[model samples]
Target: MSIKGSLRSRSLTSTPSSILKRPKTLVHRLSEIRNKPTEVKFELTKQLKCIFDGYVQKTESKEYEKLVIMIRDAKLTDADISSILKEINECISILDQKFRLFVEAILSIEWTSRGSEVIEEYQVFIVNLLSAHTYHAKMVIDKLVKLFFPGPDDSDWEDGVPADEDCAKCINVHALFNSLLSEVPMCQAIFVSSLYSHFPYYNKSTHIHEYYLHNLLWILEYRPNLRPEILNLIFSKLIIMDVNAPREEIEKYLNADEEMFLMDEETKSIKSSTTAFTQVNRHALAHTLDVCLDKIFNYFVSECHDSQTKEIIWEKAKNLYLEMLPIFDRLILPTYDIHHVQFIMFMMTCFKTTITEGFLNYLWKKVCNLNVAPVLRQAAVNYIASLVARSNFVPLAMIKGTLQQLAEWIHSYISSQDGFEYVNSDIRSHSVFYAVCQALFYIVAFRYKDFVQSKKNIVFLQSLNMAKMVTSRLNPLRVCQHAVVQNFAAVTRKYQLAYCYSVIEHNSRNTLPVIYLDEKGTTVTSDNTLNTFFPFDPFILERSAKKIEPFYKEYQEADESAETVMEETSEVDDFLLNEFPNSSKNKTQKFSYGSSPGFKFK
Candidate 1:
């Protein structure tokens, strides 16, 4: 065979080039048909329908990865999407303006996986599609505001902006948004409000947040009459939102609109500011509230270094708790369950409050019916315990059934270990023993102090009796971390299910793991998102850990009389150090200290 023929001698003649050639022809044919007004219209409409169908198919939970693959494999992925978008350079390219609106509306569909690359591709496609035909794309401006300026509709946000993001595409979306801002006053005003109402870069020293607020104020100041109706509608949606603590700076922006607009004596055609502001936009408020609560939840639970910000956030969180109290009664209590419990618990965590009275009452009523399993109850108990600390004064309204369910869990574990043949493992017996010890510790040291210390201390709650059997093997400290993950998987939630998954991922893996130690020695799980803030109060854990270094020389001692250190440090123990070893917990700076248990340290 000739050189070219020799290469095709085998049956593998239809190579990558052949496959590309076919699709290339299809694309070429599609391009050529663009010249014919009708054919271009027909194919464009057909392609849109295909994209929409693909989008709908991809939305089902089971189809996440498969849809991503399909989208990746599609002939129109990426650049092809770019090419189709390019054809739409002018708003008037289509036959009708109404038809033009439909093209922009379709961009709202989520076309890819939640991964950065996928979201970026989809965002680029939308940006290009919109940027190409600004005249017709204004319908999407508010929707774009919802997706990009602050974040996307789903849980993941712009993710990286103004930080590790140096890309031009990653340039502050405010600029592109501002270009169209002057064109659409109402949309511009709302977009400005959204950005203004969002969390600000207080730490970054860029009063960009205030800048947006000022712009909105400017618009209301300048455009008093042209479309007061549009402005009213925009500001109306903004006020009704259920946001968390608005920054201390919010007073200026919130008050500015009424202060500036109401002054216009000549704009009487518009309704007075008081009349127009009938109801607040709960959705916008919720979005704002959700973000702040998320930050608080991270500080309360994530393992970052302590900072002044954490303290400020904690107080802000307390106010949010009072605000969300009604939600617990109405939405969380009657409606939630074991399936939704993790999400509910996370929301509670985010809100940084104890389970409300009505919520616990509702949960208690629901749990007794056996619809929820003991594991879920155990999880609820764990979540409840997490909220209590040395600094936290917790009040348990009702502990009756909580104690009984806990005892029942212990009994089941004991029964699981009935056979005497097992030699090496005490998991079944150990689990029961630990549960008993924990309950006793709670009821003894904290609740029934008199009952535990008095002559009636024996109170021979045989279930609570297992503390003696378990304390030798397990410790309350280890239980706090290990039991939490196992238990939370059993319980409920109202918002952000992905948070639980993120918590689990951080706890179980070694992804820059940092465990924040609370006053009670319980470890709060942390994640990558939380690295932004110092996760814990430095005064508590950081101070304690810091003080341990000075006493390292005293760690090794011959004072058997003084050695009161527990024989076991951890259930999963490594050999005790004879000299202080480098701690990987901190990135640098090792302490020179002799190794021995300093009884005072514990």
Candidate 2:
């Protein structure tokens, strides 16, 4: 008879002595388990542990997966599974070793392809592993990997450990990981999926950040069989799980790894040796960025509930944006899709804290489009204008038009609760309408070139600059561009005021149009000096070119006026006749601006 059948028969029996008691049953079982001597108990425990492990392995095995599929098809919900485990607790201790054998047997099967609930057998062990805050999940994984997939000291699975010492070394991590990677795609997919999904739902208990250089190097460089799409997926996960991880972690994983080209460290493994910079492949990087933007925008617009989460997302995303600055800074006119315009905007919003150099130029060439939604296009334009203002660069006509577009978009998205300026102080901060004063300075100064000939555009630029200049809310009537006090006696020239204001901002918050150049000869800047944030007015830069004259004469006309005058005087009457009709031989006159803004004079 089945256990249930037996329980029913006992319940129907008339004898009161047959009535069962609940409390002592567990106590009696405990006594029975402990009654044996030390040696016998140890041996028994060991044997049963092996059996339990086997059971887990069996559940994981492909050959017996028919059993697993049958269980899955049964679709016992999580509640049913929990009840089943709870009821079997008494039976487990007595058959501990036997159960382990079953567990390991199940574990041996590949679970990667199976979806979420495939966590069945391993969940108990995983809970044990995490009990005391398993330092980091990675450490546990490393230990577990070593236990079943045993490997020795100094044996790197990635680069073949030096063959000379190899036979003595431990099993290669690559061997197990390679097998697991192939055997359990869905397992990996779930691991990554859960990890990536957990960012916003953060509890110190859940944010088990254990991944280090070893795993990252494999995911990034090797694993060719992995769908390359997984990379895009991984990047999206990082963006979504967005947390303000230490900047050092970013360096630790990607930059500190000597094997990765993104790092500056010297080569370690000769087989994978490449420059640190070369480690980040542009195509791969672009693909990752493309997906990250998509995920972030989607989450922000759809799922993100509060500004706090959005800020956290932005903080995490900002680091990624900074990492990509090298690529974006290098390319001016990269061929891009129209969809990318929105993505660029997302990046600007997230990383607006650090508006990269050449970024505006990049957007102008790639994302600016009138063919799209006017408001969307305007957002692009306004963003460029804001960058122009925030940066010390001279904002040209195209850039000014962009700022106008942003202004229009601001009006359009005003009703939007897309986690920006809908409630709190965001508008007071990152929004384009309330951008920094410097962005306007560049716009006004640079726009003169394009608008000097057009009265209407010039008026528009002046109006925008004037609006930007009214920097205070309380005193909107006043234009206080000069009132924001500046410190650091670096560059004293008005021309360099903007550079001085920006170069050292995070530490010293001075956002004025000023540069405090070092006292002239004491600290002169070199031609090669790198000031990524400082903008050079092209007209101002052109002055450094040396003037060259055509050499059509037998001897070049005397460069020195003294020699020329001497030659003319020596020629006596020939020069006296009104310079012989003003030197048919040659002519020269000094040029000057003489109070004109154009600085052009004859």
Candidate 3:
């Protein structure tokens, strides 16, 4: 008879003892499991499998909770937890429905009493299990990424109509998975691989595509090793996602007008529709491209060290640069001005190792290309200037010629403001002037001292001198006489003031006497040599030096007297201090006083 059948039979028995007696039930058997350690382990495994089977069939059972209580009540050891994990791993390929339940049960082992080491011991297994079951892991991760990076879609937003219980369950699952991933660093590789593979399928209308890119970027923050491949993928997408919108269609939507315009017979509906989709993709791709560029540049600066890695990164970047060169302006024109600067900065920053004379000349061509937007041209100038200031990649000899070219360009912009008619207004010219000035400041701040020490490099020093002279003649407010360009003037003025302030800061803080360019082209460090344009007051520094000199001399005399008294009182001779290893007063004080800033005695 079955257990239930036996129970029914026992209740109907005539004898009082038989009436009271009952056959062992499942629950009774479960209670008996607690009586012995070996029996408990066997019962635990059987109960887990039964719970899993019931879950697979969609049958109701309170056994999951009962198992939790059993594990808690039995105080399972690490050996038991490992056994449970092994069983779960074995059952994973058996039933798809049981996968999540098995994962939950394995993770539920009372890590507190079994000791935290139990989790560490099984973390690798958990990571492998998740990786082997890639589809389920990706589904959970995708849901979480969508929640975190909800794009233009309004439906997934939290402020939308209330989410049902399933959404909450997904969120809780994501948290658990995230916590698990954080603890197991090795699992990140699997997660990143899975996320990266989803890129080709990201063209859907839903914000799933946007979420996909955002997650890739999110992963990059923690895993910088993936920079090169991620950058290559992003750059490849750049060419693929180019927007070829008709010039007329783009202009029509620039200013949003509520009034409906009559459709022109000349307009092609097919082209307009294509343009709209292309525009959206281009905008999205631009953001992704920027993130890729930013991450790649940051990695090169901070974490990139292996020479082999550097060569690989350089080749990938060089290929992208060549590929993107043709479509650069077509895609970027008429976008946000900051994006223009970012594009230029990325181009400049990503090539640290492969910068050549050809590349420098190419950037020079861009800066001097009057046909280009004044803003972009100025950005090019800033990039070159930063290269000149911070990097030794550019040949020092070539920098001289580059500076000469830039000085002439700035003079041309200032003289023929009307030729800047290609731009919107004189504001463009003023901005160009301001950028040149800032560039000059960096050049002077960088190379001026080098010139001072190594005066024999006359070619570079002369080029720098010419740049300084050009800037000195160009008045800050000369480009914008009209009130319309006052904001631009203010901006130019800010850069000028910044340059002046930086010069003064260096002058004041420098310990050596400041150097000045005299009209006779003589560099001097003398206080009596006056240049009204010079920012620092030499007389004040001299006076301060004089005031402190006597006091310092008195202190020196007192120190000398003390030294003499010590010499007379001590039995040890000065020769002992020089010759012996452990002599008293082996060390002596050296005092300095009366030195001016930017001065050093030969």
Candidate 4:
């Protein structure tokens, strides 16, 4: 018979069952493609495309097994492998829009069984196949990211959930990608570029867009050079979203008599009251904002070793931070978690000389703005005080200025010897005092020399007396007294006075005044300290107590005289005078100056 007639006869007899019974026969056919006649080569390409076309429907068929084995075991020339990939791509275009079946087949193939040299040889074909199918490439990347760096919402966040078959498949595929990324230099760029291409589609589907963002961050964690490009893309999109609000929504908000505007934290812009985004966008935006903040802050604080690089990053971050000020006002939205303070602290680590003065001024403006919520004002003040206490770079004037502002606020809100606002008020009075005292304690305990040398210590103590003056107005149920006493103890300890001892002894006479360290290792007084701070002078208590019958009255009278100050600050009575109240018996035991253990540096 002629060759055409013989080929027709062989095609008729080569059924899938017959081909699978002798699976190695298909490898032999593929191997001949290099030296085959033109007609035979074209015929082999058509046959390969047909096999690829059946990847989805006949995945369990014998023909499918034969095709997989041939691809794995065949020793074809580069040209022949390229032709096979071309045929597969053609099949991919015509058969599946998602390309899920083809991707699964390609990724699921046991490349290890083919040997390392074979995988190395076929690298071009594998990458080409994936790159030509963008959807498939993304699917592979998403699977890899999900398996490796799951976000907080991912089901795998909890430890007990069992991973099913799909998860197992993803693990195997991720391992393959990891090998490819390391072995093939171009593969990483291709993967990164594919993700960058999908930027425009972010707002189209929030979950998908968030997945893309999460994957971008995850990939950059291992491969950090791509951060600049990724950040530029994210920030640019945010700007566009801000500028692209619907015209009617813009007019409705901006043209209204009052002009109601809602701040979009992620976009760093104000939107109209009516322009509410979908829950998906909101959730995605919130997560994205958190991730972006962390990335930028980390880059600014730790990642950049070169001064020039850090400066560039700091400039970019500074702009973004100033733009997002409205979002950081967490008091405006009680549920919000703003990291502005922390962000500013990190910036101080880099641009201390340039940024500290400017940032402190900004914080003061925030704290002093009456239009802003008081809770947020106190928070900003707390940040300033913390920076002052911890950072030597902070100017003395700035530190003293922050303390003055805090003291002023304490006197106005917390120390008003009048009725404070009820618990249901927008800003609780005790909270303001708590914030001030906490900030003051940091400076007093950590930076005592500066406090005394600058004469701010006296001002700080005077401000603390407001905490005392308001205690009578505080409801017995209120607990600010405990916090106030602890803060007072810290500050007065610098002067070597037994403040905790005096206050504890005065409040509950029958209850022994003792100091004990709690689990967190802070010195604490008894439950009476929780009631109020009754004014007392421990220096007088040190004097012969038997001779002073009217000492309480004299001390209270002497406190009114500003000129009166402790003559001798003694450390002999710095600790409690007796043993600690046994923890096994009295849970409310307190610490006195003479009885307590001394400071522990470690």
Candidate 5:
């Protein structure tokens, strides 16, 4: 027989039951019924509605699982997937609240694991759903947000799939969001809301928060207009974690040299037994704060470097500083006892001198504004003193000018108190005054060499009338931090700028009254001594310190004979240990008076 006749005979002999049949996939079935008559389409829609209704009713049905499996396992072409999605988009009327499970099943598919073509098709389908039914937008956005981080049980691989595939998944998710944002501008609000709402709890695992923070920062690149909101949200969440993790605990754990203690089993046992539980949580939190701030600081650095030209980078850094000011005011300024979050501003200042000046002016304004809360004002001055003292970029002229301003304010405050017959010398009532004095003394102590560098500078420093301020009845020398007072006394006496050691001696012999009246008409006795609370003392976070340390100024030891310096430091330590006892042991820095424990010598 001829070849054609042989093929025809074989085709005729092949029976329906004898041939292997290909199972109909969900995509194929949908495409077939989509172009059929209206009656057939109605029946298909009715069946889907019934299946989803059963799902909602908690009825035992395999249809939902079967559909999910088909979506998950079927190796459909891009055209086929698009066809299926197009048909679903047409049936949005029937796919209402009742069909949520069906929509979720579509969303749950690991389309990111598929090819680029499949991801694009899946994105298109999502855009269509969001455009046609705005109500499901939250559900869609929520699912995408959840994919930002890995699950607790997830490993590097599971069932032959690399868990590192989350990188690809995150890329696809952000791409889908970009499309949604463009196609449906209104979705931006929902997207931002979703981001804020889905932020991992503060106590969540470190990696989880890191992942989410990274994605949020990625969003900032495309959504430049949303920079303020996104960054504000970040700072808000960061501060929450920051305030909860005590500064002392963070310093202890972060500065700990784990390798050094390896052979000391006794030390390990003591630490583990006394502080294992509390320390673990605190350490984890501090670590998270460190890492998150590192990421943000790195991002800031990258933004500045994006431009090759120094001028452009400087301009960008300036703009970024301006943008972050409101965020700092709204989120960081008023909040008290936050250890490290404010370094975001510090990092920005490192980019340019003008940026540093701008930040100082911002803080100084807050310090001088009477409308601002007293606590906030005190916090502002603390920041100014710390920044000026610790930033290497701040010019000496600016330091002198800042000192002059602080002196002027102190003198004005003392003059204002002259009108009252009975002066309330209480530190709490006069906290801002004492705070300003502390700031002046701190700046003078830290930068005394700058003032004495030339005759003109020395003359300018002496003209500030530090003598009258120290001798006033308010007694700032008595109220300021003892370490700061001692340091100031040593530096000023050496420079002959002002003599305060006598005042210091007097303060050492007597204790200030600690009783204060509360709003409830109750007399409360509390230790209201102003702490040496320098907010920008040191950036000790392991990861981001590289960016910060180069610009950071460490506390320099006074230029004096070794014996003299040691004698002074020893005297201060004895005084603090005698008076504060508990805090003095933990809070005081070695060799450096006025420096907190966070301070470290180069």
Candidate 6:
């Protein structure tokens, strides 16, 4: 038989009528009622009310599936969707407070899980819902923000994994948000408010923080106008989490051997410690901060490096630095005792030399501005020292220039106090002076190899008058950290630049009073010691360290003769025994070091 004859001869009676007939969909019924008389439309409205009420009461009804099909069908044209939305809005009274279950069902649909065409339809529906129904804007926006994180069951899965379905959901959620923001400009404020209100709590799990932060940064790709507000909000929350975490405990846990103990169990035991349960709580917070910061650092790396040309990368990095500077000042600068949070600024500086210079100059101005708060000025100088010492991107000229300016400032301060012979060497009265002095010692100790690389460098170091600063009546060596002072002495003696051993020896023989006085000369603290905080100390975060380590400079041990090593080893043993009296012999020796002097946490 011919091909046409063969098809006609097939059994046509076997086809089912349900398969042949077009089903009556919600959108088709709603469109048909748009032009009908009031009575006819009211009848349809009454039917919609019944369907909504029945769906809420018995979720198994086929009416709920019809409603979802109406919202998510790709074959429906925009005009058809608009007509359906108009009828839904007209009958929204039926979906009142009691029918919230139906509303939630609509909002809970996995729009991202559908095909692309269906996703587009769902986006259109949500944008229109937000714009037309102001009362539902909060509900809709809250749902959108909640979608920024993974569902509770999927929380253990790694976020942003390319193979994971949840990753696509994240991308689509932000895409939907961008569409909503663009289509309904009036909802922008509401959307931002929802973001702030929905941010993961400080005590939330680490994965929760990572997922939310990753999604928040994804929003920045399209919403450049809200960059400042969004970044400020993120960093502000980060500072809160950062301050609550104790850096010392975090380091101890990170450096501990995993084979010796389980981290989760240790954290729980720490929480149960009656003497320091608060510290244990902070331990968990610290892990969350670490994960959150890693996400932010990854965002920054992608923003700066995704460009094609170096000039474009530089421009992007410069702009990013400018945006973050105010946040650093407002949130990170004045905050005390935070460990790794400010490294965000350090990572930014690594992008270009010009940016590094700009950051250094800004910090130097703060340090030299006598009118600024003393505490902030001290913190600014600390940041400068840490950045100069730890960043490989900083040039030799910039380092020398910073050292010169610091020396000039210290000399000027000493000259100003010339007439006050009765003024004692009180740390509280001259906190900034002591802070700068320690900064100078730290930088020189860290980068002394660079200074001794050439004769010109040596001359530059000699011109700083290190001996005068060390021997001044202010007695900076007496107040600076012991490890820093010892390191400075060793380097200056090795290079024949300046002698600090005599001053250190004199300081060791006598114990200065522990009393501290405030600006009003009232006693403030009895335990007087300068904080040995290096803000850029080795970035230990496992995930983000990949972005940081290439630009970071680890401490280099100076060359030592056999005799010198033997002598330093004996000294370190004695120091360990004295410092950790209760520690076992092996434990004390574990941290003992010889000749390589840098910041050593106690």
- Which is the leading candidate under TM-score? 5
Tell me how far the alpha carbon of residue 364 in candidate 1 is from the true structure, in angstroms, after superposition: 8.7
Q: Over the full model, what C-alpha lDDT does candidate 6 score relative to the true structure?
A: 0.73
The parts of candidate 5 lying over 4 Å away from their true place are: 1-83, 151-164, 254-256, 259-280, 307-312, 520-523, 560-602
lDDT of 2 by residue, 1-602 (tens): 99999998887774565455334688788888788543311011223334344556675343234333433334444444444344334235443333333334333433332333433433443433233222333433443343322123433332221233332221233444444445444445444443334322211111122122123324433464342334344433343222222212223333233432232224332222134433322222322333333433443332223355544454444544454444333331131111122233333433333344345655544333445443333334344543443233333544555556544443333335344433332222223333223234334443333454577665664454333223223121111122121211111112222222222222133223322345564544332111112111111101110110110001112123312122344433232222112223433222111111111111
Evaluate residue 511 in candidate 6 and report its C-alpha lDDT on the 0 to 100 scale: 73
lDDT of 5 by residue, 1-602 (tens): 99999999888887564567767889999999886654211112234455655666778367755655565555555665665566665556656665676688788766777778778878988897888778888999998888887766755232222345666778888888888999999999998999999998877766777788888988987788888888889999999888766766545553463531122334442232124334335556666777788788878888887646544376777777878988888889888767678888887887777878877888889889999988888989999998888788898888877988999999999999999898977877888889999998888877776767689998888899898989998989887876677667666665677777667767777875587679999998866578547888765555556667777776655332421222445554344322211221333332123235232221
Per-residue error for 150 in candidate 2, Å, reads 14
**lDDT values for all models:** 0.34, 0.33, 0.43, 0.44, 0.73, 0.73
lDDT of 5 at 405: 90
By summed lDDT, the worst window of 10 consecutive residues in model 6 runs over 588-597
What TM-score goes with each of the models?
0.28, 0.28, 0.38, 0.43, 0.78, 0.75
Tens-digit per-residue lDDT, 300-345, candidate 6: 8788885455343767787888999999999999887676688889
- Shift in Å, residue 263, candidate 4: 47
Error of 2 at 539 (Å): 35
Per-residue lDDT over 1-602 for candidate 1, one digit per residue giving the tens place of the 0 to 100 score: 68877777644765755767745567778888776553111123234334334444565333323333333334444444544444434322332343443454345444332344544544454455544455555556555544332232222224212323222332333444544455444455455455444434222111232222223333333443423332333223223221121222233333344332122335543232222434322223333433322333333333222365543355544544444444443333332121111232333342333433334444444433356554444433433322221112234323433455555655555555555455322223243244333443343222332233344333433344433223232333233333222222211111111112223333344445345766799987644221110011111111122322222111121223322232355421122221122232233123221111101111
Q: What's the true lDDT of residue 344 in model 1?
A: 27
Query: lDDT score of model 5?
Result: 0.73
Query: Of the candidates numbered 5 and 6, which has the greater TM-score value?
Result: 5
Supply candidate 6's per-residue lDDT for 133: 59
* Candidate 3 lDDT score relative to the true structure: 0.43
Off by more than 4 A, model 3: 1-47, 58-60, 68-76, 94-102, 108-135, 138-225, 228-377, 390-395, 411-425, 428-430, 441-602
Candidate 4 residue lDDT tens string, 237-309: 5434433332233333333434233334455334413246542333333333433344444444443334565
Model 2 whole-model lDDT (C-alpha atoms): 0.33
* Candidate 2 stretches greater than 4 Å from native: 1-25, 28-103, 106-173, 180-208, 211-214, 224-602
